[model samples]
Target: MERKVCAAAVQFNIELGEVEANLQKALAGIRRVREKDARLVVLPEMWSSGYAYKRLAALAEETPRVLEILKGLTAEKNMVTVGSLPEKVDGRIYNTAFVVDNGRIAGRYRKLHLFSTMGEDRFLAAGDAALVVSTSVGRLGVAICYDLRFPELFRKLALEGAEILCVPAEWPKPRQEHWRTLLRARAIENQLFVAAANCCGIQGKLDFFGMSLLISPRGEILAEGGETETELSALFNFEEMTSYRSQIRCYQDRRPEIYGTLP
Candidate 1:
């Protein structure tokens, strides 16, 4: 793994069901961040198509093309990126995050936690598996949107040797604190780096607050985006994380036998 790496998060308003426009915006963000020498990039959840639940199946058809373009871009730049998109398989739709590394598909993590309040469970099928995969940058653990609310998943990722957690989200307003706090807590407790991307602006009736964040193991915010379209970048040091883990000893002190074993 690289001792230090530059990571970036891309934030933008997603046009409902507009694949081409969203693709262009995401590509532009990636280009800008790459110029800053970012080796890894994370884009917002369901970027190619917003929560167009009625047309999710139709919109998912364009995901393969979007992935192909991303493959070409990562291959040319020799970088890795992650973002969630609608995936259609066997007539069922899933909110899946694709981790592209140097032109190849590294891994795909489906959204395990669906926002039932928004009727997400009605439209999308839930994922049963978690993803932590090796990439050109380092060991990456991937989760999407509502998964941030579940600390157990993050703990599992950390225990499985994930160096960085990449989260792609479309979180809305009136809950920005929850978004920020949970992300930092996940990093501090797990003692790893976090790069989370969230979209901004309005999509239908929902208003997204784009506070994309890059957090260190000590829970320090490295880079943060405002409530608009933007890109945030920061340098993450593996040595720093290792040192913090040694100092805190959160992992060593854990008594899973009493709390219940992680499945």
Candidate 2:
């Protein structure tokens, strides 16, 4: 049996410290894709609150409010949604990604790799584990912006039976090439579909280039957005991925014993 699902990556401009306006913009982007029959929708990292680390304490929302919006939207539309935001829990902050399925909070992933260049290390506590959540859409793995640079995380998820990987990023304009290359590399190497949602517009002195992408298991660009506020979508077939994996057999040929000496 071939399982297939429609997925969308939403790209939008976020206002710094304006939670209400940012929420409205995110919801509007989701609504647009929902009309297109997207069963799984992904929003950019910090879509509700901008990535203004200096004002993180004041801008970050409690878990309740973020979940309420995500769960409500997913339940109302009967779809799955994934997005990252700044969460303040137990007097500590973490860049977390929440997976909402049919209005319920199915899973949460705190970003393990914090981007030091952006001062994420100073403002947020790093997550200790990788998150792979099982949902109606498929077995999905979640990663944040900087986490995409590490292939080991994606490989671990692949070994754990993840069929699709979703990444929400606030990737900047200067490193846009790295963003595109890394995404395609992850999909190709892991032999799974990769969907990345990135934000646009300027935040303080930094500018974000919105090139949200959906890449296939074979490293093909199925859908891609330009440097603007838009939504990119595509369909993923699990059966095709299965066939490719069987043919390649990359996972079966790993020499873990010899490569265990690193670090």
Candidate 3:
């Protein structure tokens, strides 16, 4: 049986190298989203670090600390939350994101495609496995930051029964068009709801594109934010994704059997 769920996307700014302040800001957004009766809240990538990609050594938190805190938020609000954070695991550093559901971690996905143009590969390690988790809302697929540019990732997730794709990003201003176009393509082609939460304002020298968007299966932007902080909430009907997929049969038309080494 399918359930009806409301999703909230929190678009906000963060303090560079200040986890305490960012968490306070993010916590306020969480409370606000809960007040609005949303069952899930989405936050931007590396939000706790203000997309301060340079300060991983100083601002990065232990993975356990992140999970311990988000557990309380999920339990108290009775909802799920997702966002990316810089991780320190077993002495290795990774740019990663977590999906918290029902008071515990549903799963975590690492940012596989590091943007070398931004020198991300210089500081962080790329992740190997794709994360797909089954939730009460639906099967959720997670991709952080640069992962949005890769359509094949969404295709694989769609093939795995993912009805909703959560993208937590720190996309800067210059590439706003790419962000919007790629996000919509992912939603329309995959026949899934795309909830993309991006940071607003400037983080160090880079300015973010604040068009945090929640889109429908038909590739329409149901809600979009401007160049400021906002918690954009919208209701999505999973039935639409299901109905479109059944009618169009996009998945069935795939010729994966003859294809090899798809990105």
Candidate 2 lDDT, tens digit per residue, 1-263?
67899999999988888888888888888889999989899889987777777778777754468679878888999899999888888878888899999989899999999889878898899999999989989999999999988899999999898889999999997998999999999999999999899999898898999999999999999999998899988999988998998999898899899889557
lDDT of 2 at 152: 90
Alpha-carbon TM-score of each model against the true structure = 0.98, 0.97, 0.95
Q: What does the lDDT read for residue 72 in candidate 3?
A: 92
Residue pairs clashing in model 2 are: none
Q: What are the clash counts of all predictions, listed in order?
A: 0, 0, 0
lDDT of 2: 0.89
Writing each residue's lDDT as its tens digit, candidate 3 over 36-142 gives: 88877789988787646566866665446766888998887788888988887776678788889888888888889999998888888899988888875678888
User: CA lDDT of 259 in candidate 2?
Assistant: 88
Ordered from best to worst lDDT, the candidate numbers read 1, 2, 3
lDDT of the candidates, in the order given: 0.95, 0.89, 0.84
Candidate 3: misplaced stretches above 4 Å? none
Q: Itemize residue pairs with steric clashes in candidate 1.
A: none
How would the candidate models be sorted by TM-score, starting from the highest? 1, 2, 3
